[model samples]
Target: MEKLRIVFMGTPDFAVGILDTIYNSQFEIAAVITAPDKPAGRGQKVSVSAVKTYALEKNLPILQPTNLKNEEFLAELASYNANLQIVVAFRMLPEVVWKMPKLGTFNLHASLLPNYRGAAPINWAIINGETETGVTTFFIDDKIDTGAMILNKKIAIDSNENVGQLHDKLMHLGSETVIETLELIEKGNVTTTIQTENSELKTAYKLNKDNCKIDWTKSGIEIYNQIRGLCPYPAAWTYIKDGENEWNVKIYDSKYIEEAHTYSIGTIISGKKEMKIAVANGFIQIESLQFPGKNKMQIHELLNGTQISSEAFVK
Candidate 1:
């Protein structure tokens, strides 16, 4: 077998560890392709992608292609002479780019394939109250995450785990999986299982403001899952109202009490030091949260700054 030359593609912190592990391995990283830098925050300063930052520290060749199908970009990419391309936390690839490599393009996805096949897999897995979700490596196909599976490793989702915590676990696990996958591909010992489509399968749709809003009508368990699943990023939100005054609140951490409750859903129960929201058959005790124009703080701190009225409710 010939030596493998790899082109790694990814953005964000999730992909950084995998790239680092790959770099330390015996295989060659011919180049890295990440998203183009753009202005971010109030400063409008150009922001470098995490992958690019790592690549620069290692002095690995980098490509920031705004258009994957652009002729100039393709020519530059082809110059790398990489036989295999590894994608992690990257955008969908064009066939022209993915098909360029002879050993083929394989991706490290955050969820077990054929299940949470979309952008926000880790978030949806927990939000749907799934107790088990795992990482999978597969050869990229024409569709998203519908590729033939090369390898997978399952891990249990703790009852209290948030998406941020789950993400770290999967990332570390994915690093191990990626190295194993590289060895298999390099040694020509790879095998794959075709993914089957099932209508019953739950899809991981992209998170948006509309979908992230807290729907108090659901069971307390569901609302709890939703809050934890989106914690620390694109958080699950609701409006806390005291009479006509309303504040948009983002819930980060919460615990559920399953005792029977006669109060209407979305009703706020608050004392000087704590806050809980009424839901079907229970109350959700908020642990940490944030309001618009404010940083995340504990529920007690939220109460300390502003006293919620007895008539206050969340909707």
Candidate 2:
């Protein structure tokens, strides 16, 4: 087999592990393609992407093209002379770039193909109360996530697992799968499978406030899934309001109990150390949360710092 000269494309922390795997593999990494550095925070300090940071640490050649279709950028990317490209948590690629490599480009997605095929797969899978999810590697094509699949590996989702935990699991899984896919390509024994379509397919669409907001009117189990699905990032939120004031609260860790209850949904049943929100058919015991204009804290900490009136309720 000829040597595999690979160019890796990714940006976020999720992609860092896969990049490291390829770097330490038998294949040669010709260059890295990551998002450009941007200014952030109150002080406006420039922040580099996690992938770029790792690439700098390893002294790998890095490319941050502002415009993927720019003539000069495309010319420089072609100069790398890589045979294969691996994309992780990166932006959508133009056909001109994805088709640059001789062996073609493949992407590692966070969820099983044809399902959860969008930006926030990890979050959506758990939010939708799925019992199983996995990672997939497929050859890049024109449409999003519609390419011929190369390999897939499945894993069960724990009952109480949050998005953060699931993301770590898939990241590790993707690293392994990418390595195996490279080997399959090298041996020239790989068989690509076209994805099947159905009317009931689930899509992991982009998240927004409309989807992240907690609806206490729903069953506790449904709310519970929604809470954990979005936990630790773009958290599930509700408004806690008393007779005097209302505050936006982001709920992180929580547990729910299903039982008969007369209390109206969205009621805030709380004591000094404990806090629970009444949902349809049950209550969600909040373990950790964040208040407007404050850092995250345990339910007890928030209770002690800011008292909740007896009439407090959620909106």
Candidate 3:
């Protein structure tokens, strides 16, 4: 097989591992394409993407294009003479870009194709109470995630696993799959499969504040899944009201209590070092949480620092 000249496109930490895998492989990495640097954090310091940082360390050729369709950017990309283009955790590509390479561009999606076919797949899978999820490698098509599948590897989700844990698991899994898919392409053994529609197809669109808010009116199990799905980043939140003051508090970890409860939904039940929120069928014992302007803390620690009155309830 010819030594594959590959160009990798991705951003964020999730995309870093896969790019690194390809970089270390026998295949030649012609260049890397990542997002442009932008100011981040309270201080607004310029921040580079994780892929870009790694590429710099390895001294690999890097491209940061603000516009994919720009003539200059497109010309620079085409100059790489890459046989294959690999995309992971990157923005939607234009047809001109994905079609430039001799071997069409392929993406490594966090979830199985035809299901959870959008952004935030890891978060949505857990939030929807799914017991299993997987990763897929597919050729890029005109529509997002509607491409022909090259391969897929299944993964079982732990009962209490959050998106953070699942994210890492899939990140590593995706790297292996990318390597396998590249091997197939190099050997001319690629067999693309068309994705079909599923009756229970659930799309994982972007997450917003409204969707991330904790709905205490839901069943304990449902609320538990939602909480775990969004934990660590962009955490599940609820409004905590104390007299005239009301504010949002992010809930990171929680345990579901399945016993019968008469307490109204959103009620804050607390002990000296414990905090629980009453939901439809029971309560969710808060394990870890964060208040505005405060670092994340254990339930006990938060109890000591904050005043959660008896009348406190999640909005």
Candidate 4:
């Protein structure tokens, strides 16, 4: 079989895994297209995208075009004469770019097609308390994540799995799926299946600041899942009022305790060893948390080092 010339487009760590697999596989990578480096963190130092960093280390040719539709960029992309393009965790592409490759551009999505098709698939799956989620390799079309599927591999979502854990799971699974899809394409035996015909397609819409706020009025399971979904990054937060001062607390990890509770919703409950907050139905014992200006730390450690009066309440 002739080695397919691939142009890989991606930006995040999830994309890096797929790129690494392709790099080590039998396929030929003509070039890598990734987001441009931008300032990040408190120092505001320029930071290269995860995919770009890996590509640079491997000495792969890299393209960082601010606009995918730019004539010059498109012309430069066409110069590579790639047989196909692979997209993972990258911004939406225009028809001009997706249609440029002869074998067509394929995207490696984190969730099963027609569901969680927006931006934060891993987070959304956890938030919705899904029992299973998977990755899909599909053709890139005019619509976002609405393309015909080339391949899909389902994986179970553990009841206690957080976004961080689920992300790693899908990252590895997606890498292998992308490699397999490419192999099938090279053999001229690939088949494309349309997404489900049902109209109730779940969307993984982009997460924003507003949605990250914890609503104590929700059920214990809902609050628990939301906290876990946003943990470690874009953490789910709630405001705590202490007299005249208000503090924003980011919940990093928690567990749902089935024990009965007398406190009303949004009340802070504490024990000798644990700190929990009463939700609508049950209590969520916070294992890890962070203050507005502090780094994430265990509740025990935070309590030992800093004094949190029991009288203080978390709004």
Clashing pairs in 1: none
* Residue ranges of candidate 1 with Cα displaced over 4 Å: none
Q: For candidate 3, which ten residues in a row score worst on lDDT?
A: 301-310
Q: Which of the two candidates, 3 or 4, achieves a greater TM-score against the reference?
A: 3
Instruction: Report the lDDT tens digits of candidate 4 across residue range 35-145.
Output: 998999999999999999999899999999999999999999999999899999999999999999889999999999889999999999999999999999999999899
Single out the weakest 10-residue window by summed lDDT for candidate 4. Answer: 306-315
- Write the residue-wise lDDT of candidate 2 on 54-164 in tens digits: 999999999999999999999999998999999998989999999999999999999999898999999999999999999999999998998999999999999999999
Question: Against the true structure, candidate 3 has what lDDT?
Answer: 0.92
lDDT, candidates in the order shown: 0.93, 0.93, 0.92, 0.90
TM-score of each: 0.98, 0.98, 0.98, 0.97
- What is the descending lDDT order? 1, 2, 3, 4
C-alpha lDDT of residue 238 in model 2: 90
Candidate maximizing lDDT: 1
Cα displacement (Å) at residue 184, model 3: 0.2
